[model samples]
Target chain A: MRIAVDAMGGDYAPAQIVLGAVEAVRKYKCDIVLVGDEEKIKAELAKTGMANNPHLIIHHASEAIEMGEHPVEAIRHKKDASLVVATKLVKSGDCDGVLSAGSTGAATVAAKMFLKMIKGIDRPSIATPLPTTHGIALLLDSGAIVDSKPRDLTEMAMMGSIFSKYVYGIDNPKVGLLNIGEEETKGNKKVQATYPMLKQAKDVNFIGNIEGRDIPSGKADVVICDGFVGNIVLKFAEGLAVTLFQLIKDAIKNGGILAKLGAVLVMPALKKLGRRLDVSEYGGAPLLGVNGCCIICHGSSNAKAICSAIGVAIECVKNDVTGHIRDSIAEEELLANDSETI
Target chain B: MRIAVDAMGGDYAPAQIVLGAVEAVRKYKCDIVLVGDEEKIKAELAKTGMANNPHLIIHHASEAIEMGEHPVEAIRHKKDASLVVATKLVKSGDCDGVLSAGSTGAATVAAKMFLKMIKGIDRPSIATPLPTTHGIALLLDSGAIVDSKPRDLTEMAMMGSIFSKYVYGIDNPKVGLLNIGEEETKGNKKVQATYPMLKQAKDVNFIGNIEGRDIPSGKADVVICDGFVGNIVLKFAEGLAVTLFQLIKDAIKNGGILAKLGAVLVMPALKKLGRRLDVSEYGGAPLLGVNGCCIICHGSSNAKAICSAIGVAIECVKNDVTGHIRDSIAEEELLANDSETI
Candidate 1:
């Protein structure tokens, strides 16, 4: 299988992206088309001692999307941008999937423009894998459709559940709608309307409503919400984790000799704790419901994170995660019935 | 000033409530009218050695609202419920303010029923104090109006700003609308609509938009949002903090002898960290925009938390928080002018 990597994307782009692609080619046994300026890509690959590798191919793209540029305008105007070229490669069947740690909006726009949507899918979602006490919970629509309807949320549930089963190997992933309260009646207008749709969904392992508190406790395998809320939730958790860890580190460093000794003892466990909370090892967030398997990594992702993101691309492509989502949507015919109420 | 305390409310009930009231009475030299079952409150107060204290008075309340019961239904039927009687005390000028740790819904209903609304106010909001890197940030509409309009959010901004200035002693607290992005155009319908109102609110120290991630970093003193989003944000932060702390503890405990030693050294710092994050020391969430000061404590509030809640009541009352909110609303007449576009 072949995957397209947006080499120009991310903070440590070109170098990190090239390294990640090289590592993925070695481990996942997948060919990668490095979509960016050929000279920079070749130089990075040569530095990594993978210049002559048969599995790695360079595809030159002239333009690049600046991080702050508007996604729609960038995607439309900068046709030869690395992100746009990568998605086109997927659309043309030259690559099975694509991965980009670029601006989410740019990635989303380019993907939608070229790769288009899967059959029967109204809109796509970003499935962000969050670490829970038990395991990973797939949070969907993390930065996709901002103002989603009830039917759209249901679609997200179906897509997230299908993706989770294939990606995480959960036999019957529990599905839940993010609401204010555990009760079905609780939440805003869209949440209230979506509750019954999710509950009556025969394919969904509906576990009623899950509150924000239940998120860290692993109340559901798939927690679905609109992109607006999902983005805030993800960012908030990231910020909180950062703050708390800093607080702990400061506390330990200033605790004098005894504290320093204790810190030494707990260093291993602390490392383990860090790893357990690090969900990126699994892979970057996958933009679900799109025509192709497209994974989006964080902007500051390191070589390992990028490698894991490419791994996601490879696994999703092999498992036909996107195809399964389409099949689930087709099989359930949920969107058809859901739209009637709307 | 005499504040009414719901002696029968919260998980700890009369014991913690009585203890908190006694502590507040001693520290602040404020009279407290314990509103609940007279005999039970008297007994609890007697144990605390404040039974016949000149500043402590027992206001007989025949009924109590169960935590799980429908708030509106309970407020309607349980006429002599402690929460209702406490509000009536405020309304009748018998008390300057009231504090309840019972069901938030019950407290909301009782406050709305008896205390009514200040002139020019559209809706009341619950101001929940959250720990930030710098200091405490006041989050409003935490569990009040679940389905809030843009105007309700504007009112929350005004009320929260007023409360923050009085309670936290910030000269002019920066007011911000909680949003997915810092951009003015970024957010759901309510947030988008509320943005311009807050920005145009000359009376408020409006700071455009703040994402959830900005909350813990102390980006804004007053983080304003509709109640639904506010509640979820609060709960999510609470859950994340709990999960992270547990993970840290588990890591230390299971890290063999060395890790345990590190944990020991960090114990003092850990306690300080805990104290910093423990917002309850400041007070329970106060329901703002009400006609009078009404603080709502958590159900699991202990004596210390309740004491803080009462302190919030007294401070807000002393500073004329509700009146300032009224003046701000009256000053701007924002919603009335804002409705033209909507």
Candidate 2:
């Protein structure tokens, strides 16, 4: 299978992106198409010693979308841009999927505008794998749609469940609505309205309301919420982890000779712990409900992050997560109709 | 100053609460009134060698409010409850402050219904201390009100600033509005509406929008948000810390002989790190906007947590935080009118 990589994306641009694509092609044995300025991509490819790699190809583009630009407008106006062209490849089935470590908003808009959503899906959801005490937990609608209706939340839960089962290899993934309290009666009007709907959905393993504390424990395989709340939780968790690690480092450095010695002794364990908390280690976030696989990586992602993102793209395509979700949702809809008729 | 303690509150009940109250009276030189079943509190007090402490007093209560009970109804109906009596002591000016490691919702209601909010304050906010990279950060409205208006958020910021300045000992504590992005145009409708309002308020050190990721760095001295989002962030941080520590423990436990030896060598440093992240170590959350000092500890708090809660309560009263906030808001109102006239 072929995957289109946005070579102009991320903070490290052509160099890291190019090297990551080359490594992915060699390691995963998948055809890699690099989309960016041809001259720059070729230069970086030469540096990586993969200038003549048969599995790699280049698609030229002139303009690069800045992270600060408006998403929809950027996708529409910058049609020749690397991100736009790469997304088009997926839309046209020239590539199995598209991966980008660019502006998340830009990638999201491009995916929705070009690839479009599968039939019967009202909105697409973004799901990221969060490392928890039990294992990796899937947090969905991380920052896709800001305002969500009750039905929209139910749809996200269904989509998240299927994605976890296929991509993460979790069977009968427990889906929980993120709320302030574990009780169904807790939370604001939006959560209160969505609780019953989620409970009634036939296509998901519905667990009741899961509190914010439960997210880190992996209390539910699929933790679903509106984009606004979900985004805040995801970013907060990321920030807190980084802050704590920094604190630990500072304490070790400044806590006198004994502390420094202790730090030296435990450096390996701490390093491993840091790696476990890194978002890039789990790959990129998947934009569920789309017709084809689309992964959005962090804009500041390095070479390793980009490589992992490509791996994630391959897994999504191989598992047919989008197709499974579409069919499951369709079955649920048909069953609802039959019950109504009866 | 006299402080009322709910001796029947928290998971550890009379043992922890009674011991904490006796210790507070002896160490802090504050008069303590333990509110609970007289026999149980006295029995527990005897073990702590404080049965004859001159500052210790007992106010009998017949009932206890469960953690899951409805706050408003519980406060109104359970008049003889430990939490209710503690709140009443503050209302009647028999105590300078009230401390409880019980139902946060019930404590909030009791404080509002009995002690009442300070003049010119529309609503009360829950202010909890957050451990940050730089130092401590104060996060307000952690779960007092779920659905908040722009005006409510502005008030919360004002309250948080005052609390930080007085209790946290910061001269001009920077106040920020919590959002998903740092951009001025970021966040939901409430945040969008509240931004200019907070900027216009004369009482606060208003910083621009702060993303969720910046919170743990202590980017701002006071981070303000509506209770819904604030509560989610606070709980998520707590959960992540606990989960990470647990993972560390598991790794050390299962990593064979060499790893276990390394873990033992670093156990002291790890334990110190764990203590730094403990919510109980930060003291109880203060219910801002109340007329008198009222601190709400976690329902599962132990003796150490209860002691910290009492210390926080004394600090709040000594600094006269509620009075300072009320006066500052009044000054802001005057300045707003003056600006309008100009």
Candidate 3:
């Protein structure tokens, strides 16, 4: 399978991206099309001593989209941008999937503009996998569609459940509506309206409402919400984790000689805990409901994270997750039509 | 000042409440009115050896609201509920303020029913003080009004600023609208509408938009949002903190003999860090926009937390927080009238 990698994206840019692509080609045995400036990509690849590898192919693009530029405007004006080129490769059937760690808005807009949405899908969602006590919970619409309707949320639930089942290997994934309270009557107008619809959905294993406290405890496998709330929750969790870890480090640093000695002894176990909570190992979050599989990584992702993201791309292509989502949406529309006739 | 305590509220009930009231009497030199079942209150007070203390008084309440009951329904049916009676004491001028660790909904409902809203204020908010890297930031509308309008958010901003300046002692509190992005054009429909209003609000020190990550970093002293978002953020932070701490403990436990020994040496420093992040020491969150001061503690609060909440009640009464909110709302209304005429 051929996977297009946006070599110009992310904070580490061509260096880390090229290194990850090389490793992915060696590890996953999949063809990698490195899309970016030819000179910069070739230099990075030469440093890795894999410049002559047959599995790694260089697909040059002249323009690059910076992180701070407006997403739509950037994509519209920068025709030959690396991200745009990578997505075009997928649209032309030259590549099975694409990956980018660039601006989320840019990735989303380019995907919609080029690759387009799946049939019967109104809006696309970014499904983020969060590490929980039991396993991972897929939180969707994580900043994709800011103001989502109840219908949009239901679509997210269906897409999330499908993604979790096929990609994460959770059979009959439990879907939950993110609400203020666990009761059916609780939450804002949007959540309250979406709750009953989700409960009645045949495709979703609706487990009622799950609160913010339930998130860390892994109350549900699939958590659905509007992009606005999901984005805040995702960012807030990241911030809190960083803040708490920093606080712990500061405590050890300020403590006397004995505390420093204790820190040395506990370093191994703390590192283990950090790895367990690490997002890098879990690969990147996917923008669901799109025509092609597009994995978006964190901006600071290293070579390891990018390699994992490539693996995620391979998994999506092999499992035909996009095809399953399309089928599910079509089946739901059929069910609705039959009910209307009755 | 005399503060009425809901002696039958919270998980610990009359025992912890009475102990806290006794401690408040001794430490703050304030009078305490315990409102609950007279017999239960007396029994709890006797355990503290302060049954006959001159600073303590018992006010009988016939009913108690459970945590699971509907807040408004329970408040309506249980007229003599401990929380309702405590609020009545504040309304009748028999007590300076009231404090409860009962169901937040019950406390908010009872406060709204008994104390009523300040003139020109349509909705009340729950302003929760979160411990930040630098001091505290007051997050408002933290579960009071679930579906809030732009006008309600602006009111919350004004009230939060006033409360922070008077109670938290920030000379010029920076009020921020909690949104998904730092840009003025970002966020959901509600947040987008509220941005310009908060910017033009003369009473608030509007600092544009703040993302969820900005909250723990102390980007603003007063963070304003709708109750739906605020409640989720509050609960999520609490859950994440608990989860991370438990994970660290588990790591130490499973890290073998050397790790255990290290944990022993690091115990003191970790305890100090825990104390720094402790929410109980911050007193309790205040229910703003009411006619009287109403401090609401966490349901799992211990005797120390209850005592701190009593201190919060006294602080609000001494600082005339409710009066300031009332004056601010009236001033906003007057300004609106002046602008309309022009």
* lDDT tens digits, residue span B242-321, model 2: 78778887766665565666666656665787688777787788999988999988877887777788888888899888
By descending DockQ, how would the candidates be arranged? 3, 1, 2
lDDT of 2 by residue, A1-342 (tens): 999999998988988888888878877999999999999999999888889988999999998998889888888898798999999999889999999988988988888898888888888889988988767899889988777788889998998888888888988999999889988889988899999999889878998998888999889999988788888888887777677777777766656666666566666665687688777888889998888999998877888888888998999999998889879888988998999999
TM-score per model over all chains:
0.96, 0.96, 0.98
Predicted candidate 1 versus true structure: per-residue lDDT over A1-342, tens digit per residue: 999999999999989899988989899888999999999999999998989999999999998898889889999899899999999999999999889988988998888878888877888889999998889999988978888988889888888887788878998999988888887778888899999888887568999898889899899999988888888889888878777777778877777777767667768988998998886687799988888889999988888899898888877988888888878878677676778879
What stretches of model 1 exceed 4 Å from their correct place?
A334-342, B334-342
lDDT of 3 by residue, B31-116 (tens): 99999999988888888889999999999999999999999899999998999989999999999999999999999989989999
DockQ of 3: 0.75
In candidate 2 the C-alpha lDDT for residue A278 amounts to 76
Worst 10 residues of 1 chain B by lDDT: B328-337
**Candidate 2 regions with alpha-carbon error over 4 angstroms:** A256-258, A270-275, A335-342, B268-276, B332-342
List TM-scores of chain B, every candidate: 0.95, 0.96, 0.98
What lDDT score belongs to each candidate, Candidate 1 first?
0.86, 0.85, 0.91
lDDT of 2 at A104: 87
Interface RMSD, every prediction, one decimal place: 1.5, 2.2, 1.0
TM-score: model 3, chain A = 0.98
List, residue by residue over A1-342, the lDDT tens digit for candidate 3: 999999999999989999999989999999999999999999999999999999999999999999989999999999999999999999999999999988888999999999999988998999998988888999998999987999899999999998899989999999988888999999989999998889887689999998888888888999998899899999888877777778888998898888888988887898898888898888889999999989998888889899999998899889999999999989988998999999
Estimate, for each residue in B1-342, the C-alpha lDDT of model 1 and write its tens digit. Answer: 999999999999989999999999999999999999988988888788777799999999999999899989999999999999999999999999999999998998888888888877777788899888889898888978878888888888777777877878888899988888778877778789888888877568998898878888889999887777788788888788788778888888788887787677767867877887887798888887778888999898999999888988889889998888777777666666777768
* Model 3 error, position A100 (Å): 0.6
